[model samples]
Target: MSLRVLALLVLLSIQNLFAQQLSPEASIRVLTIGPGYNLNDAFGHSAFHIQDHSQNIDMVFNYGVYDFDTPNFYTKFAQGKLHYLIGVNYFDDFMLMYKRQNRTVQSQELDLDTGQKQALFDYLLENYKPENRRYLYDFFYNNCATKIRDVLQTAVGEPIVFHEPEAFQPQTFRTLIQDNLKTNSWGSMGIDLALGSVIDQTATAEEHMFLPEYIHTFFSSATLGNSNKKLVKQDKTLYTKQAINSNKSSFFTSPIFVLGVIGLFIVIITYFDFIKGKRSRWLDFTISVLTGVIGLLLLLLWFATDHTATAQNYNLLWAFPLNIILGIQLLKKQPKPWVIKFLKFLFIMLALMAFHWSVGIQVFAPVLIPLLLALVIRYMYLVYYLKNEKL
Candidate 1:
């Protein structure tokens, strides 16, 4: 064997030896970091903390780590093909970073025996190795918080009975997400637009751990398989967040106000066309083309992207793709019979959207209320205009 290969083997052996020798004073903890000001940090973070006073070892194992230097980073991320890796850093450094951000930091020390603690620590080290670290990230099924929950359960080699928190109730994935965001914020509107009806289904109780705060709550009450003993031994708050000024927002820039204005403008134009006994071809073409484009994009997201939550989108009911084909019919002075039928279909689709919302099949963004009303009124006028014209 080459000298370099032999040295590498020796170094790995030494590292394994150290991992197996975790002292009785060592503790394995779950660290939950509170939310921050950005969309990415809105859900917060979860990590494993390993501390051994006797051996002078204190480090955090984080599964949410991703490198921006990765090739084709933006493209891969958009396609949901980005790989996230487990990273290790000193505990003090991790704490300091969150402190600087003014985010609350909390810790829950697991009630693991010395053998279990050593086993978990060793397992984490093995997972941290280059070959095993990187994993495909799934937003709902496999993420930072879920990883911590799964790893801790695996380390215990027991069925963890995660009891539902007292305040827990069933909620859809979109509702859970919107709960963390401002109702009228750009982020919320973007999420509603980009994601489809798949996220409208109710999330199961155990599935709620996808969020860091829920992980903390569930783990606090979880127990070992069929045992009365609780999983967490102690809970500690490492840092309290300081209040920051929150009066930095305005209503005019919000989606509700912006879409509302557009809706009002559409209504005014339609009323003018009614009085003149004429249809605005430009406005009709624009709305048709816009909805057609949005429909095409939603279809692409549903079929092409790896995003699991974008399937079965009902938004296409209102943003019909057939509008592209029907839009050309609007330019002609004499409308085709098929065009009138298509207008009726568009009005029906709008009604179906309202029905869907009413029956809780899917909940759309509230910002769309005014826009939907305008669409219905415009379609009704178009149908009347075409039918009343001389054949």
Candidate 2:
């Protein structure tokens, strides 16, 4: 062979050898971040940490990143069609952001062999490349937590046997979510109202890994494929929250208290009208319009969105879209003949909602109890008034 060919072969061999060499000081860890004070961060977050002392590299690979500048950002996000990308950030920068938020951060060092560690690191580097990074985000099936689980299993080229956490009990997705939410908070109520029957079904043990906390818990005892060897070599807290009273929220401002006050107002107006044998068109109109608009939103979530949890919602029974038409009719001194029939239909729909609640078909927001009761009374009176009022 020519000297040029020999030199080229030598350079190729050198590159290959360098690529295969992962420094003994290199470490691979999974970082689990605790919840923040926002709906989006309520469930927590997960990311991979890669540090090599010899290479002067310490970076975090985050799968939960999305570009806000993407075309039709809000629309695509609402429809669940937005792309989430893997992002590389310096370890200090990443930890600083979380610390500033006062969120707890925990790190788990993985028990990966040198070859496995390099394979995983190389895979993450490739995934961080612009064209290779973006992936379709799914709440339950795929997300940051599941990404870590999948990457570790793939890197090790072995099945990871995730032992169930000691505190884990079988639970529905909604219940699992509720564990993080304050019972009477708007976030909890909004989730219950927006989501549907599908979330009520019991989630399997493996399915619970969709949440970051569960991912951390299960991986604590996870073993390498058919071996007694553990997946995590060591676990330690990267950051712990300092006691800060300023970050606290008050229960008086919560959804339950606010909704209860509104329910009381509705009941007073409704009761006074029933006793006086006179209907308050404005109050009735407000109820219909409010429920109707919410119903329309729920309909869009169920049909137009790619969110699986929003399907087959039973909240529609109470917040019917027809309430808008009925509300418009309530504006007339003498409504059309169909008005009474529609009122009756609404009352029956409320009954069906009660059945669903009792049978555990769909669990609604507990904060809605007073409002629901008031609606039932108002709806009943509307049916009676429309039938008995002089035409």
Q: Could you tally the backbone clashes for each prediction?
A: 0, 0
Model 2 TM-score on a 0 to 1 scale = 0.91
Q: Alpha carbon lDDT of residue 282, candidate 1? A: 83
Residue range with the least summed lDDT across 10 consecutive positions in model 2 = 10-19
Worst 10 residues of 1 by lDDT: 10-19
lDDT of 2 by residue, 1-391 (tens): 5746754654353334334456877899999999988989999999999888787667788797877878999999889888888876668878998999999999999998888888888888767666788898888888999899888888778889988877778899999999999888888999999999999999998899899988889999999988879999999999997778775678789887788888889889878988998889888788888899999999999999998889999999999987898888887778789988888888888889889989999898989988888887887888787778854
Give the runs in model 1 whose Cα sits over 4 Å from its true position. 1-20, 331-335
lDDT of 1 by residue, 119-212 (tens): 7888888887778888889888889999999988888777889998887798899988999998888888878877887788899988888999
- Residue 322, model 1: Cα distance from true site in angstroms: 2.3
The TM-score obtained by model 1 is 0.91
Name model 2 segments beyond 4 Å from true. 1-21, 250-252
Clashing residue pairs for model 1: none
> What is the alpha-carbon lDDT of model 1 when measured against the actual structure?
0.86
Please, what is the TM-score per model? Answer: 0.91, 0.91
